[model samples]
Target: MTDVFETDDPETDAGATVLEVRFTGDEGRLDRALALALPDLSRARLQALIAAGAVSLDEAPVRQGSAAARAGLYRVAVPPPESADPEPEPIPLTVLFEDAHLIVVDKPAGMPVHPSHGHARGTLVNALLHHCAGSLSGVGGVARPGIVHRLDKDTSGVMVAAKSDAAHAGLSALFARHDIDRSYIALTRGAPHPRAGRVETRLGRSTADRKKMAVLRNGGREAITDYATLRVFGPDGRPLAAEVRSTLHTGRTHQIRVHMAHLGAPLLGDPVYGSGGVSPVVREAVAASGLTGQALHAAVLGFVHPVTGEALRFESAPPPAMQALAAALSAL
Candidate 1:
C-alpha cells in the first residue's frame, strides 16, 4: 500500500523534524511499514525510533516495533544531531593546581567528564573550555579536548587536564605505562574476606547488561587493584560497613566497582554493582547522609609533572555526604 508522507518545514518542538505518514490499509508490521514509508531511514533506525517512543500513532505514543500496522496517521519525531564541538559553560571549578602545561581540579560528584548521549551540557569539558579560554590542548579531539583520562560521572575526586599538546602526550604516556599513582576511597557493605590483598582479573562488558562492566574468566583486559580495609564500622566481628582503599595498577572502565563487587565488598550506594540486602541502620544512614550515588572518591593522585618533571600529588577528602555517612556508620 502506498503511504502519503507530509514533511513539516519548521521545527515546532525541541529541534526534532516531524514527519507525518498516513497509511490506508494494514502494512503487516509497524517497523516494516515505517521503513518502507521512510526510505531514507534504515529499518533498524526505525525500529529504535519506535522503541524510543519517537513514533506516535494517532497522536498516541508507539513503543513497540512489532505492533500490527493499522490504517492511521503516524508521526515520527527525529531528533537533531549533536554538535561536533562542545560549547563552554560558566561552571565553577575547584582548582588545585594550574600552570603552563596542565590544570588540576577537584571534580565533584554528579558531574560528567564529557558530553554523551543523554548528557550534552554541564560537563567538565564544557566548564574547562570556559576556564581555559581556548588554551586547552586538542589532542583528545573536539569532543573531549585536553582530557587525558576520565572519572565516572558519579565518582568524585581529583582530575588533571592538559593545557598543552606536549603535556597531553606525556600524561597519556604516563597513564598507559601505569606510572601514575591513583587511589580511591570506597565505603562498602561488609568487607573483603581477606581484608587486604590484590585483586587481579580480566574485566569486560557484562553479557547480560551491555551498559555495565563485569569480571570475566576469559578474554577482556587485565585489571589490577591493591586494596586494604581502612576501617570497619558497626560490630567488631560482624561489621556493617567498611572504608576501603584501592590503588589502581591498571585502569579499566568501572574497574574498582566491579572488582570490589567481585570480592563481595561493592561500594555503598553503587547502583550498578552494589546489590544485596543492607542493614536498616545503614539504609537509614544513607538516607540521612544524602549520599545519592556511589560512595567512591578519588582520594589521591600522584605523578611527576609531564612537562616540568616536578613531583606533584593532590589529595581530596570525601564530600559532605560521605563524611556524614561515615559519621553515622561509626556511631552504629
Candidate 2:
C-alpha cells in the first residue's frame, strides 16, 4: 500500500505531494480533518506533518495538531519517502574486527545504525555498504542489512554486523536467547539508591507520549538490568552524581534510560528521561563537555562467534565528551 502522490511542483520529488485541503469542520481537530481530507495519509502522519511545520492554513503556519479546524484552505507538503535501498556512502568506520562472515566496529555517537526519516544518509549501514562492497547479509532487509541489534543514535559503542546469512541467523538467535554480554556506562544526574541492584520492569510505549518508552505495570516485554555505581562524584558530604555500569539481561528499546529514570537517577544530558534539577557545578561541567545528548556509552560487548564457534569480546572507552564530563565531575 505505497501511496505515491504526484504534484505539480517542479521541485517536488518523484513521490512527493503538495495537498490542498479544504476544511469546513469547526469543531474537529486539524489533524483529523486533514486525515479525512487526505485518505491516503494516516492521522499520525498528518499530525507529524503538522508538528513539523509542513502544513499551512490560509497562508499561515499551523503548529498544533489539535487546533480546532477552521473553514479555510490548508496546504500540506508531503516529502517523498526515503528509498528502501540505501546507497553506499564512504563514511569512515573504526574497524575493530572484520572477516568474510562478520565485521565489528566501534560505532561513534550521533551515527544512526540505519537510515530513517530525518537520517537518510551517513548512517552505519551506508558505511557498511561501502566498506563491505555489497557483500553484507540480506536477512535484516535491504535498509538494515546484517543489523542484529542496535545502540541508540546518541550512544557510542562496539557493534557487530554479519556479512553472511548464516552468521546473521546465528547472531539473531543469540540475541533472542539473551546470550550476549552487553554492558553500558552511564554518567547520571544522581546516584541510584542501594549502590548495586537489579532493575526489572515491564517496558512499553508510553500512553501519554507515543514517541517515548515507559515502564508499564502490565502488558509489555520484561526488561532487566544489573547495575552498580562505579564512582560517586561531587562534594564528599553530598553526592551530586555517579558513574553507573549497567549490564543488560534483556534488550528493549531505551531499556537502560527508562530504567535509570525510574530509579530517580537519569543519565546526564538525557533530554527525554533526564528532567530534573542538577547541581549548578555539574551543569556547568556538562556544558563544558559539549555533549549533544545523553552521557551513555556501550562500554562492553561479548559474544561467541556465531559461525566460527570462537569466543569474541570487545570493549570501548567512553568518547571524549563523556570522559571530559567524568573528569569535571571528579573535580567537583
How large is the C-alpha RMSD of every model relative to the true structure? Answer: 2.4, 3.1
Candidate whose lDDT is highest: 1
Error of 1 at 285 (Å): 1.4
> lDDT for each of the candidates?
0.92, 0.90
Clashing pairs in 2: none
Worst 10 residues of 2 by lDDT: 1-10
Candidate 1 segments exceeding 4 Å error: 2-6, 9-12, 22-52, 65-71
Best by TM-score: 2
Tell how far residue 158 is off in model 2, in angstroms. Answer: 0.6
Q: Write the per-residue lDDT of candidate 1 for residues 1-332, one digit (tens) a residue.
A: 66656566463457788888888887888899888888988898888888888899898999988988888899998888889899999999999999989999999999999999778999999999999999999999999999999999999999999999999999999999999999999999888778999999999999999889999998999999999999999886888999999999999999999998898888899999885667888989988999989999999999999999999999999999999999999998
Residue 50 in candidate 1 has what lDDT? 88
Residue-by-residue lDDT tens digits, candidate 2, 4-31: 2335665445566788777655748878
